[model samples]
Target: MNNHFKTAMDQVKAEEALILRTSSYLKNVENKNVRRNHFLQKGNQIMKKYAVAAALAVALIGGGSGVYGYYKIPVNYLSVDVNPSIELGVSMSGDVVEVEGINEDGNTVLEGVDVIGTTVEEAVQTIVESATENNFIEEDGSSVVSITTETDSDSVSEELTNAAEEGVTQALENENVEAEVIKSKIALDRRDQARELGISPGKLNLIQKLQKLDSTVTVDQYKDAKVKEIMKAIKDKKKEVKADLKEEVKEEIDQTIEEGKTEIDQTIEEGKAEIKQNVEQKKSEIKQQVEQKKSEIKQKIEQKKAEVKEKVQQIKAKNKNNGTQTTVESTTESNSQ
Candidate 1:
């Protein structure tokens, strides 16, 4: 009986040890399953985050690409061609230059003028006359004005000589004819002497000199022979002097004409260049303006996309937190049950 009781106690002890071992194994298996499930949940969360990031990146890249393309496209295209039918006429004389354009329509006339006269009075007079005839001058006479006058080489020379002769003759007639004849003859002889000395006579200077002569010569008769000699000398000298001066003036005018032609050509070329530059500048400015507008639009689109992405991230975070809290509450309720 004693041996049997000992054996029974040993058997009970073995059974209890087996039960403990089984329980430990089962607990280990359960822990391992929980660990695996946790790992899977974490992996799924990471994958979701990556997906969101990829979408945002794609959106941003697309927006940037779209903006680039928009700007790349040409916004303003300008085409320029010279119109052969459109005639631009330029007329120049002395310091006056006039430019006029004839368009397709007969009534259409575009004109511009620039004058640089030796004297301010001449410039102002020419501008006023041209403006008045062309109706460019306003009623108030305070408008931008330009005028041009053309005179041929030969015509200008003739006119100058005639003006000088008339001026000289008029001064001689103004003095007393009989009494001052002697002094006049002396003056004429002096003018001839000047010519022989290679001194060129100036009309204005001669007139001034004659006006300064003594008034006593106007009533004197004793100097008649001397006066006759002076008059004859003066007449002969004037004819020769006028002829030489005309030749010299003609040569100068011819040279001036050649220079004027060259200047006019240069002016036309410069005007065309300026027009081309302005057109190019306008085209570039328009293109830049369009590009700027496109850039603005692109930025706005990108900002909107970013805002949307931010909102989506916020919603995802809220859902994740709520799910975690609900799971924790369920676990607590199960333990309580």
Candidate 2:
């Protein structure tokens, strides 16, 4: 009888350990670090195996930084891709990143130049300032450099264009590069033409601009139009579209805002489905720490004395649609007088 009592004690110890482990596991389900679908699947299994009162309660709480991407409504870039190919991509914060080559001559001009951390204005100054200091060009105090800004921006209110032009012109004059500053803005029609043709807006813009001048020009008719004609057509189309950019910007923003709400809802549902499936697979695998708990769970299933606490966390995720935006660009001739 003493041996029988010892065996009973050992069984009770195992059962107690199981209860402790399962209880801890349930508590962990409430942990934010744990994925929510884990609770959902495990919650479903517990519900099916045990009474509703003792079973798990499931609240599928989900959310994320939805629609993760980037778009540029008014992407502005300044470049002088002459022999040296100098292009400066300016960010919303005015930070400059070199998007083009620093050829031998370009490097000579930008030597010791801290272009990385500098603002657009400061960066342009650095280039032109270095150019003048190195005597790359004769500074005769005459506006010899023409600063024209091209973009697909639809807002006259966009200070980036004129701001870039004025800023660059000033930088040139500060060091006496003696360059003529002529600011030209280009806005293309049917900005969606690029999407339809699977080409860059800038490329489609040039094609469409050519078509504007010669109604015969079309995407399929590219071979008929010489490269020279296409280039000239875009220049002519510039004046016409420049005045309409600001109006178009206002309209584009309104259009996107209205569509984003519906699109975001669909994306959330898709995200939830993916999360649930992944969680189910992960929960099916038993961990070493909870190794002995599974059998104990079945044993305790008949007993209603054990207590299980239900913790529910609700997640409300607001998704911001990271949609695509159009960008337009144009380059000048190699030697601009």
Which candidate number would show the highest lDDT if scored against the true structure?
A: 2
C-alpha lDDT score of every prediction, in listed order: 0.39, 0.48
Q: Write the per-residue lDDT of candidate 2 for residues 3-89, one digit (tens) a residue.
A: 987887777655778999999988876553353233223322332233222212221122231111111111344543212324455
Candidate 2, poorest ten consecutive residues by summed lDDT: 65-74
lDDT, residue 200, model 1:
18
Which residue runs of candidate 1 sit more than 4 Å off their true CA positions?
1-237, 254-265, 268-272, 275-279, 282-286, 289-293, 313-337
What TM-score does prediction 1 earn? 0.22
lDDT of candidate model 2 versus the reference: 0.48
User: Taking the tens digit of each residue's C-alpha lDDT, what string does model 1 give over 228-308?
Assistant: 233443455566567788999999999999999999999999999999999999999999999999999999999999999
Candidate 1: C-alpha RMSD after superposition = 62.4
Cα error of candidate 1 at position 305, Å: 1.7
Model 2 residue runs over 4 Å out of place are: 1-74, 81-85, 102-104, 148-150, 156-158, 186-337
